[model samples]
Target: MAPTAFLLVFSEPGPNVPEDEYNDWYDNEHIPLRVNTPAFLNWTRWKAVDGEKPTYGASYDLESYEATKKAPYTTLAETRSDREKGILANIQLLDRRHYELIEPHPIPLRHSTTRRNLPHTSSLSPEEDFNKWYHEEHIPLLAKAPGWVRSRRFILKDCGQMGVEAQKDQKPPKYMAVHEWASMDSFKSPEYKAALATPWTEKVFANVVAKERRVMTFVRKWARL
Candidate 1:
C-alpha cells in the first residue's frame, strides 16, 4: 500500500499579531476550511516548545499521490492566497514542505521522519562536515538502532507554485533531507542511545547546527480510499 503524505506548514505570524489571535485564526478559520476540502484527509496543529515567538505548526494529509494530484484547488488556492495577502502579505511566515513515506528495511511496521536544514544560518559552516557525518557516520550508526528499517534521503527541489511566493523565483531553503524510522520506540533503543553517545554525533552538535533549529515530527495516518 502507498503511504500517506502530509503538506506541513510551520509559521510565526507578524510581530504585531498576537499569538492567540494567530492560533485562533488558524484553529477556527483556516484549518476547518482545509479539512472540508475533498483532498485533505486529516489535520492537526501544534505549538513549539522552545520558541519565544508564538509558533504554530499545521499538517494536512492526502489519501494518496493520485488523490492529492487530482484534488480541486480553487478553494484551497484562494484560501492560502488570501491568507498570504493578510498579515503575511510581505513576510515569509513559515517553513512549508511535502513529505511521503518510504518502506522500512527490516521492520514490518511503517515509519516516517523529515529533516530540513537552514542554509547560511546553520552554525555548522562548510556544510560538508555535516554531510559527511550524516551519511558516513550517523546513518551507519543508526542502522544498528532497533526498529530502524531502511532509510532514504532526498534533496528537496522546487515545489513550483506550491511554495510561499507562488513565484518560481522565490527560493525557500537551500537544502532539505529526510530519515525514516520503523517505530517511535526506536529512539529509546540501546543502539540509538549508543549512536547518540558516539563522538561523531557530539561533533555534529558542537560544530554543525546552531542553537536554533526547526524540526518537525508526524505520525502517518492511512487515509480511507
Candidate 2:
C-alpha cells in the first residue's frame, strides 16, 4: 500500500501576505513536517493560471487509506506552532479532496510523470454522469494524446474521520481529475485540444463549476519512507 492515495489542497494567500513569504513557509516548514511523517511518499505544490480564486495547490501521497487517515495527518488542534498559525491566517482555502489512485492502480506511478495538475469539479447532479463521462470518455480519449502519462480520478472521501479537515463547513471538491504529463507543452498540442472539444465535453462543461486548469511544476524533493 505504499503511496496508494493522495490528499489535494488548493489555496490562496490572503491579500496581506507576500508571495515569497508564503512559499518560504511551505518550502521551509510545512512540506518538511508532512514529509517526515509516517507513510507519506511525495509532496508537490502548484500555481493555477486558469483556475479558481486563491490559485495555489498541493497534494500528498500516502501508503494506504489507513496511512492516509493516520494521526500524523489527521489531528491538528494539537500540532500548530505560531509559524503554522501565522501562515494559516494569511491564506484562504479554496478546495480540499482525498483521492485514491484509480488510474495506474496497484502499480506505483512513474516518478515525475505528473507535471501539471488539472483539477475541476462537475456540477452535474447525482455526481455520477460527470464521473462516468470522465472515466469512460474524456480521460480514455485524452490519455491517448502525446506526453500524457497517466490520468487519475479521485472522489471525495469521509475526511471527517481523518486527522484534521482543512475547512469544516465548506462543501468539498466532489471530484478531482489529475493528468500527469511529460512536458508542459504537451497540453498545447493539436491532439490534446481536439481531445477536449467534443459535443460530449460541451455537455459536461455546462454542468461543471469551479472548472479550472493549473500550471504546476516540480518545486522540491524530499526523502520518502
Candidate 3:
C-alpha cells in the first residue's frame, strides 16, 4: 500500500535564544513554509506534557514518500536564511524522525492519529522475533477497538542530524508506531482498554527502554484526496 509519511521534529531552545522568538521562528516561519509545499498535506504541533528532553514537537503528514526526497523539500536545509542559520546555532537539541502509515489500506483515516514512539534496547525474546510478534500478534489485537482507525510502523531513516549531539550512554528509538483513531474520545472506550490488556501487550511493554507519546490534532490540512 502507498503510505502517508510524517516528518517529525523534536526540539528545545539553546541557552542564549529568547523563548518567544524561538517559538515565532517555528510557528510563524518554518512550519508555514513547509506546510505550503505540495507534498506536505497536514500539520500539527504539540507540547511535551509528559516527557523530558524534547520540550516541543511537530509532525507534518506527507502526500507521498517521493515528496520528502524531491526538490524544495530536499533543498530546504541548504537554503536556510541567515536568521534561520543563527537560530540553528542556538538550538540545543533537535531530533528528527520519519514515519509512514502501515495500515487500513483502501479506507483512509479521518481524524487524529495517536503517535507512539517506542525504542527497545533489550527484550526477553530475540530482537527479530520480538518484532514478528508485534506485527502479527500485538498490533492486530490493539487495533480491535471500535474507534481504532488504523496503525502504521516506521523505521528510522538516517539523514540531517546537523546540530544534534548523540548521547554516549543512550540511543534513539529503533521503531515508531502510529495508531489512528476517529477522535480523542475514542481512546476512552472499554474496547480500547481491553485490547491493551492482552498478554502479548504485557510482554512487549516490559522490555521497552524509552518511549514517548504525544496527542495532536491538525491545525490545517491540504490535500487532493
Among these predictions, the greatest lDDT belongs to 2
| RMSD of candidates 1 onward, in order | 7.2, 4.4, 4.8
Model 3, position 58, has a per-residue lDDT of 72
Candidate 3 deviation (Cα RMSD):
4.8
Across 1-225, the per-residue lDDT of candidate 3 in tens digits comes to: 233676777777767567798888887777777766677777666665444556777766777766778787888878887878988876777767665654433334435444332211212334566677667776666566566666666655443443435343444465666565555565678877776687876777777666656554433332332
Task: Show where candidate 1 strays beyond 4 Å.
Answer: 52-54, 65-69, 79-84, 90-92, 104-192, 197-225
Give every collision pair in model 3.
Answer: 102-152
lDDT tens digits, residues 1-225, model 2?
456677777666666567788888878788878877776788877676564455677778877766655687775536877977776765554355666755553223445534554444423333677766776777767666777766766666644222123456665545567777767677788878887898878887876664445566545556653
Off by over 4 Å in 2: 75-77, 103-129, 158-168, 206-215
lDDT of 1: 0.51
What C-alpha lDDT do the candidate models reach, one value each?
Answer: 0.51, 0.65, 0.62
What lDDT tens digits, residue by residue, belong to model 1 across residues 168-225? 4544443333434545566689987887688877877775433333433332222333
Pick out the ten consecutive residues of candidate 1 with the lowest summed lDDT: 114-123
Select the stronger candidate by lDDT from 1 and 3. 3
Best by TM-score: 2
User: What TM-score would you give candidate 1 relative to the actual structure?
Assistant: 0.53
